[model samples]
Target chain A: MDEKQFRDYLSSYTDAEKALSAPMRDTIRINTLKIPKKEFMGVSGLKMEPTFYENGFYADAGPGVRLGATWEYFLGYMHTQTLSSMAPALVLNPGERDIVLDAAASPGSKTSHMSMLMNNKGAILANDVNWERGSALFSNIARLGVLNAKVTVRDATRLGINAYFTKALVDAPCSSLSQPYAYKKFTPNLSYEISKTQIKMLFSSYDALAEGGELVYSTCTYEKGENEEAIKLLLEKRGSASLQPLGVEFPHEPGLSEYGKEFRKVARVYPQHFSSEGFFIAKLKKGSA
Target chain B: MSHVTTFREYLQRQFGAEVPKEIVLNEQEGVIRAYSKTLMMLKPSGYMGFVAGKVSTRGIEVKSEFAQLLRNPSRNVLALDEAQAKAFVESESVAIAEQGEGLRIAKFGRHVLGVGILKAGSLHPDFIGKGRKRVENSINP
Candidate 1:
């Protein structure tokens, strides 16, 4: 979007600039696959406060606390993540017995989080289209002691079919509208292109799910076209697809019904709302036989 | 802790490290990996699963990812004091006569620091993966 349009769009939110530009506290999701959350909460040094979500924490240890530099982090007991980003995995809630697909997984924040959610049981196929990102993804997965997820550098839209996965997550990439802190390079044309790709990824994710399984389509960007529009298109094209209310409870806006009434079930997070990042999440269930 | 398999057999013999049998171990480009059995069914194209060890000129050298994955090793452990523990996180070498000449699990208190080579009475630790420890962070040596 252009400057005026962008400001107009952001104008709806309270303290949009100040909140988005503000530096957020580091969020640590305790890797229960390694160290139990309760035990980690007892560890000293870093000042930790629990979030509303289970196992999510706001961690700080003075200036330059370097949570990333601690043995606890390196040993895979914890992973540094944004609180906003944690919501997708929590919403997906892949169980120990379910096979999962994480399309467009890179740097593996959500993918590894799903691995932890699965408790290292069942399986996950984490695919990223970029080679460099795949390396970082594998690094995070291995470092976090995530053994249930496998890394693949390939176009996520081309992944094998057969309704294999019980659950799927497409945290599709988008322009950094999520973080006004580092937000740039947003244009109507670019957003349209990206939205197209997001729809394709969403379709692939839904198709990858087994009949009766669920698919979660999420993006860091909140543009109507990127978030609600993508889901809207999926529901229209695939009659089997239907929006499901996010069983997850976190602070955020309800999805816009502009696309359709069911879009309200989608979760839309605005950075200004809680000084978190902008994110959109929607849970969809595939019709079963 | 009981792990004696082809990928990390030497570690089992050396440090009594335990690797679960459920892992489908495979060696890719000198590094040994343990993949999820269910994930392996898809035949992923790029990197997959956890790294167990590496194939060096001498033999399989189990890395710190293995220790971190397995968490605790039962034997051949070299416990480090404050000064030595500092050196371990910094990836430095310090002399320790406790463990015999070979690779041992370097420990600072009860936590595993990774696999270390204890040869000629000196220990060199390697905690593989991103985000290493800050030297300022202390451990009782």
Candidate 2:
């Protein structure tokens, strides 16, 4: 979509077009499993302020200071992630003793965060279809001292594992609409194909979830087809599943209700609202299958 | 039986520590992996991979990625000063004030970076690799 067309499409939401061009913020999450929040903040030299997420902080790193090179980072005490990217895991909110599945974990930003949240207590099946990405995920899991994670390379939609998980995160692959620089190349066909795959992945994730378990489906794109429409399709197919509100406080708009009432309860983070990347998150609860 | 005993003995000799009872040490082909019962259950079918580290003639040489999982601080651990810690992360060898023998876990403050070999007064931060460099860039940049 062109700038004008995109603006017209999101006419209902103020600043949606302007937010697309705004500079993104750099945010980091402290790995509480490895280090306490206060201790990590004391040692990290960067100027930072806490985000809505308790462990997350927006960092104003100076030109010479590389947040990734710090000793704390080497110790897996912190991860440089976008504030929006950190939401799905928090929304999923897997307990310390719950077995969780990271459906599309790669390079493991969310997987490692989930591991930290679980305090490395329960097992996490971190799977990715690509071999190269899977290796990156394994390395990150190891570097971050995530002992509870088991790496696997397989198509998430076709994963043959029979074991049911208490929680699951489907950070579906989508068009790079949220990426500030990728707006020029956005196309309708690409969005449709990604939406189809996302719906398939969601169905598989729901099947893997234990009855009465919860799952969070998220995408970085703001495209309604990839976000709200995909969730609507899943809800249609799986009658036992229903959307749940994400009870966290952050700057966000409700998911587009035109798709469904459940979508209205879902959450969307626009860049204009928080100086972060655009993201969509919908929490689903599975009833008896 | 003898091989298992030798491996156990090597673990004790190298780190001056004993493996936790919950962790089972298994040898496949030539690599040795330490897996808890929970980890074994979580393993995917047809998956052949190491959970802990590989067993080598030198000792049970832990993978760099698995280095942080080692909690037992032994004589093998070499705590570096601020300057040496910076250099060690840059993949540079630094001189230690006091010399230690054998493989050492290179630590900065309370955090373990990875393993290194100390001979004489010089410490070779061989464990510093892509992961370390990535960490270094995040801090130094």
Q: Estimate each model's TM-score.
A: 0.90, 0.88
Model 1 TM-score? 0.90
Q: On residues A1-289, what C-alpha lDDT tens digit does candidate 2 reach at each position?
A: 7777776655665466567566788889888866788787777777788778888888866776677766666667788899998998988887767878888998899988987787776778888888887767766665666666777777887766553888899999998677754656778888888888888888888898888889999998878888888788878888888998897778888987577565777998888777788898999999954
Proportion of native contacts found in each model? 0.47, 0.29
Q: How accurate locally is residue A221 in candidate 2, as Cα lDDT from 0 to 100?
A: 80
- Give the DockQ-based CAPRI class for model 1: acceptable
- Maximum-TM-score candidate: 1
Please give, for residues B6-78, the per-residue lDDT of candidate 2 as tens digits.
Answer: 6667656776656656546666557665444455556454222234555555655655545565557585777
- What are the root-mean-square deviations of the candidates from the true structure over C-alphas? 3.1, 3.3
Error of 2 at A186 (Å): 1.4
Q: Give interface RMSD, every candidate, in order.
A: 2.9, 4.6
